[model samples]
Target: MSGTSEGPTPATDLIQPNVTHSDATPCPGTEQIAVPAAGQTAAAAPSAPSRGGPDAPLPATGGTTPMAESAPAPAGFTGMDQQPSAAPRRPPAEPPFRSAFSAAPLAMAVVDRDGLVVSANDTFGALFGGGPEEFTGQVAADLVDLTSDPRIRQAYQQVLDGRRARLRCARRLKHPDGHPLWVQITVAPLAPESPNVLLSVADISARRELQDRLRHVQNHDPVTRLPNRTLFFERLSAALEAESYESGGSGRVGLCYLDLDGFKAVNDTLGHRVGDRLLAAVADRLTRCANEAGHGRTSVPLVARLGGDEFALLVEGSTGTEQLAELAESVLTALQAPFEISGRQLSVSASIGVVERQAAGTSATALMQAADTTLYWAKADGKARWTLFDPERNAHRMTRQALVSSLRTAVDRGEFTLEYQPLVGMDDGRLRGVEALVRWRHPRFGTLTPNRFIALAEEDGSIVPLGRWILATACRQARRWQLDHPDEPPIFVSVNVAVRQVWDSDLVADVAGVLAETGLAPHLLQLELTESAVMGSAGRPLQSLRALSDMGVRIAIDDFGTGYSNLAYLSRLPVSALKLDGSFVRGFQHEENTGENAAGQGEEHDGAAGRPSPADEVIVEAMVQLAHRLGLTVTAECVETCDQASRLRRIGCDTGQGWLYSRPVPPDRISELLGSRC
Candidate 1:
């Protein structure tokens, strides 16, 4: 490889320190070329034509000449004084695209099918803190962090094998100088059939940072600087999922759904600005509570503003219901303090619903619903308290809702039937009439009594249709009983009607139509209403009672003395009967322990096993006398024994209806008893 100093030298002898070649010599008939050192630019101007050759260009300045130009001729010194027949054949020109690839602005590298970096442009080498030659033969996958993610690695492999067109993904990288960088890496085949792939990387840190900022804004509350409903729900859902608990966590979640009591009043009277400030203040206290609750735990609870005056604290990996209860109590105690807003001392309280359970089968929606129901219970039980979610209570409410939803349908489906309790005349011990009671034969919840569904029906207006059904059925049955017993005076039927039946329906028309359709005398039918319903009667109710009374139908007050007993309406209204409540009759019992007073056990008792309370006797006697003086018959309820009946009969009560006569029975049972007296 050495060359003599007097003649043109071989290109290998003049190789620069920065440049190296794998081949020692050129191929047959080809000449070797020299490359410049690093950081030295090649002169762009064309060299002057040689004087000894046919306008041949000189070699680049400050670099070795080509082998053909440096070699000495076989003839004597052919130099600037000698002219040749033609220009010497120049070494084959370097590939034009290679230079462009090296100069491209984009950071790029060429990786062979073996996943080794065959070559990298200067820009790529600079980007990764290395020179171009230093990157050669390195694993391209490691250089770009493609192997960190299996999905990206797989796609990169596919692109390397020419099985896939291209692959692009984002990656976070740390530079050697301790700074973070986000880059988008792309890999694609250099050509359709090429064995090499070109990998390109672009800086995307600014874009990622912008996206993170936007996401934060979207997931946070502006006023509280805490998570909003969106983020709360997201975290709740994640916590409820089984996967969230698989990482050695507690596998339990808890939530405290909180609402500021009387918040709407504050907004209405003090304006929304003050209301908003109060809510923000509440949020701050809630956050503090969450932080304190999370002490000595793995993670702090998430506090979020659900909207307006409502906020929630979500605890993942919760210990149990006890932890949730403690958290809820903390919230209540924290909110008890007064908030100073707009120079006014504003006082507010919160009602919180606490729910906690295993995360395996729970959902965010179910948890929130339970919490909401418990919160309503807290408010109803009186505000400024915390209520834990009780599955039993929730089930009862759900059953009530199910009953309410099906109440109207139950009527149309004929799922209801009547049971009649006998009312016996105290004087003659003869059956005076039967009080009609309604029962629902629910398919799912069998045999529901009036106490269970009646109020629900009343609330939803289902009582109107249900009451009409009861009236018509009772009248028709009573007429059948009359025809069955021609010898016995027709025993009357008394049906209980809700107050809503009077206000919501034409009660007089319904009663008159039923009597005409059943061919039963109006005197044989009586409608009983609660004392509350009949006490302050006026308007449509007063008119309805007067009309029905004029038609010969009797009106009676049920559960007397249990409500506002305004007796003034008795002289003006058309009420013909009074059914005293069972509580009064319950106290009218013979004393089985007459000697208890001597034993120092004498105390005012409920007559459970003692002598009749004198107060009850006097009250019953006065009511019975007042009722008889007003021309209204008296009926005593809950008469359970002959002694009680004797006491009621002595009180001059006209009728007694209780277990002493018979428990409420079906229509057929009542028919069996119609021929006999109590």
Candidate 2:
């Protein structure tokens, strides 16, 4: 029995009823003793001499005492009235904790304040392949391998010194049979005031194995067995962080993002299954390329499949652009080879965008964005090539993006104005008609000419609204000129049209509406288009051109000789005039002189500087004659000198529009010219 004497013992603290004590009887005239609580000092029995006599009643303790019932004495003893000898009774049976500690199912041991093992249960002994008695005098930290780790050793010491309530950690241990075991160890004080601690160890190998398997499956791509996008971004973030914080590294990172060119065609022509096999093969080649690039390096590059046909190779601590470029080239060469799949040999090319830079100020999202844009450049430059990122080019692209985002809004805000370049009669030097040029009055960037943004407009289909605006404004200005200079003949206004305008909008309807709205006659308005747009015109474009021509609107081809200069199609199409490109006119800036004439009269012929070369003269003459034969007039552009104009007139050119007459001027200037002509 072990319990407190200060109060009646609780039933739970008493010795188990099942643990029977044998061959014992209470001494007569003595009170039954009470057990002390665990970890509490037990009261000593009254001394033999202190008791007045054997039959004398024991002195009363401060707390209530248990009384014994009268009963017959044991066979060898006298009746209940007999006095018992004062010799010290046999020491009370060993405390109950000993039994409980021995019978516990958990592997546990008791460690004294000095970190020595006081005792160990059978279960604890089996953990290290020894008997409980063998572990008793051993150092507890050494037995559990805690001494190897300084942090764990310190924590274990804290528990033994009673400074910490408990300590728990995990360890990888080797079993006596040579197999490895994963275990969780815990140490706690045996009692609130006791220096001894209880240490427990639990096996956790199965849980750890399951967790490892799940992590592998989560971070890898099933199709390629390569790290997936999640893991790829994770590693990239880590590399960037390390480059930013850690010392003594290259401080640069790089990536090669690529995809199989025309892979969709393969999937469409064949099947997805074949496409998948082709992608797998491509991944394998890319992996080998990465490994080859990593030779002699500290860390191998990571290859990841970022969904679909896209893949990326990440290199940490990259040396420079040269290293990344070498990797890209190797990838290109590897993918160029044909693959044999499903009894068919398929050939495919790859477009790779390589980006490498100092990792100091870059982020994962920004790096990926740069790589994607570079890949687009590679495709645009032509497939089967690798392109490195250029900051200047990216800046241009960013500016273009800004312009794109604001284009339609610019139109709605009326951020455009029209300028008219004079189209003068080659012989009379009189204004015949004016070509309408569009200018963007950008808020941030001062007035930009057509060359700066027209292509962008067409590509994005914003030219429809922009072209419509130009047409209406030019026609309105021409009508105003007609009213202001009544004495002069009304000159037609020629407006430039884009191919996209015909396909994206109803050109015929737009023209009719503008004419009707501005009260300008169709014959007084002309539409000028580049040769490339007008050549091989058919479908909606051909119909639109014919409709405009039939409405008495003039159709002139601008930049004629630069494109399909097929004069035969001139007869079949509804073209009204030909505007000879400036390149041909530039060739006439100087005349070729015979050797003797040039030597004798070099100074005198300086005034004839703009004479045409023989070949140019012949070509212009032939084209002018051929156009005349087809009932089409001719306009020569870029006429910058008097001699050039005179030569064009001599060649029977009908109109001249260039710096020679007037640069593209504002509507008010055209009004002044019209009034002056009147």
Count clashes in each candidate, considering only residues at least 3 apart in sequence or on different chains: 1, 4
Instruction: Kindly report which residue pairs in candidate 2 clash with one another.
Output: 3-35, 3-36, 3-37, 4-37
lDDT of 2 by residue, 1-678 (tens): 222111122223222332223355545555444544444433333222332433556555432221234555445433432333443334345545655655666788777788877777777878889777678768988877898899999998898888888899988889989998888899998667464788888778899789878887998988888999999999999999998788877899999999789889999999999998988898899999989998999888899999988999999999999999999999988987889999999998889999999899999999999999999999999988999999999999998898888898898998999899998988778888999999999998789999988999999989999999999999999999998888998999999999999999999999999999999989999998889889879889999999999999999999988898877779988888999998888778544466776688767555534344668778998999999999999999998877778889999999998997899999888877873431
lDDT of 1 by residue, 345-423 (tens): 8888999899988888778888899999999999999989999999999999999999999999887898999999999
TM-scores vs. true structure, each candidate: 0.83, 0.78
Q: Evaluated with TM-score, which candidate comes out highest?
A: 1
